[model samples]
Target: MKSTTSALLNRIEFPVLLAGLLIAAGLWGFVELMELARAATPHAFDTEILLAFRHAGQPDNPIGPLWLQGAMRDITSLGSTSVLVLVTTATIIYLLLIRRPAAALLMFVAVAGGKVLSILLKFEVDRPRPELVSHLVNETSLSFPSGHAMLSAITYLTLGSLAARFLPDRTTRIFVLGLAVLTTVLVGISRVYLGVHWPSDVLAGWCAGFAWAMLCWLAARLLQRRKVLADSE
Candidate 1:
């Protein structure tokens, strides 16, 4: 019995350990990107990309409607606070209703904590918004780590993971994850298109977002294992 329990603990701990290592790696990668973005002087490539991204907000682009523009703008304005509070409340209610306190708590922390980490990274990097082109939409934050990209990744991926719980097949699970990733990518692109962020900024956001999502998934997996062990006892 002791050996079996030890093995279970090892299995359960693996994901958390992996996540911690990944988070550390992500932090290093984000720092490296920041250094590169900062050290490189603005070039023609930056100028061209900035122009193109800002152009996306123009009336001529059929891909983006006025309403969608308005929505993205609104979401960007919420900063990190909106998602944190919303996810927290929702997770609490969900846990209470479903009687899965561990899972709920883990989800809440993963989402909420991701938001907080995003903010800290933003301040730490302090990369200015692009000056090569004028912004079509309103934006007033540091541009290195795109907030919309980060939040969309966290929120969508979290929800997708939860959704996958009900899905039995591997294909369905992959589909859910793909959808979450696609949404995150679209949101990041929209930021660039609206001239609110640079392509490099979006790239950094993607890296950071991916890293954070992996960490959150790791936490959730660990929580699930704990629940499984509890049930066994």
Candidate 2:
């Protein structure tokens, strides 16, 4: 039994082990954040962070230079549905062009399934958008989990993992993964800064999105294993 366990552990890559732990951590974080979101008023931390983006008691007046607000809006749009769709479609097409149909399909499933899951989670949480500050953009969605944060994490991380597989070295792989994480963080922060989501909303979204992306990676790994088995047979 010990030998079997050792063999199994050896079979799993370092990234796979790390992903498993992240999945658990993400789920735990989401559950805890959900409880905080259920409160009638935004948490002190949530309100404070949201207000930090604005100028002294002027919710409409965002902090930083005049150009910053516009830049932030553009950054936030990187995670918007239209942009994500376009990126995903382009990636899928590229994968297909490279004759990697399975990879293309997995990418499609990860992003699409993540979207469906995000919608369902929003409905389940039913938290309203932050009323403590004026919204910088128009958004009417239920706001427990920031959709932009969640979907950005899902799409970017999934693509990062996929791209890493093709990259030649560990440094390049890490860089790709880091960029994915950085993009996810930037999107989440942008959501809160815009007052379209509370800090907790973005936190929960990050947790759930990372978890979902890791789960899809694991699923793809399993499918590849099955294909290997079939081929061997």
Q: What's each prediction's TM-score?
A: 0.72, 0.94
lDDT of each: 0.69, 0.90
RMSD of each: 5.8, 2.3
**Residue 91, candidate 2: how far off, in angstroms?**
0.7
Candidate 2 has a TM-score of: 0.94
Residue-level lDDT of model 1, residues 1-233, one tens digit each, is 99999888777666466667767886687776777667667545555776664345543352446787677665554334565467657766876576766556656766777778778878987878876655657678788788777777777777777667769998999999899878777777777766767777777777787688777677566556676412112
Where in model 2 is the C-alpha error above 4 Å?
A: 1-7, 228-233
* lDDT accuracy of residue 217 in candidate 1: 75
Q: Which pairs of residues collide in candidate 1? A: none
lDDT per residue for candidate 2 within 93-177, as digits (tens), equals 9988887887888889999999999999999989988887888889988997899999999999999988998999999999999
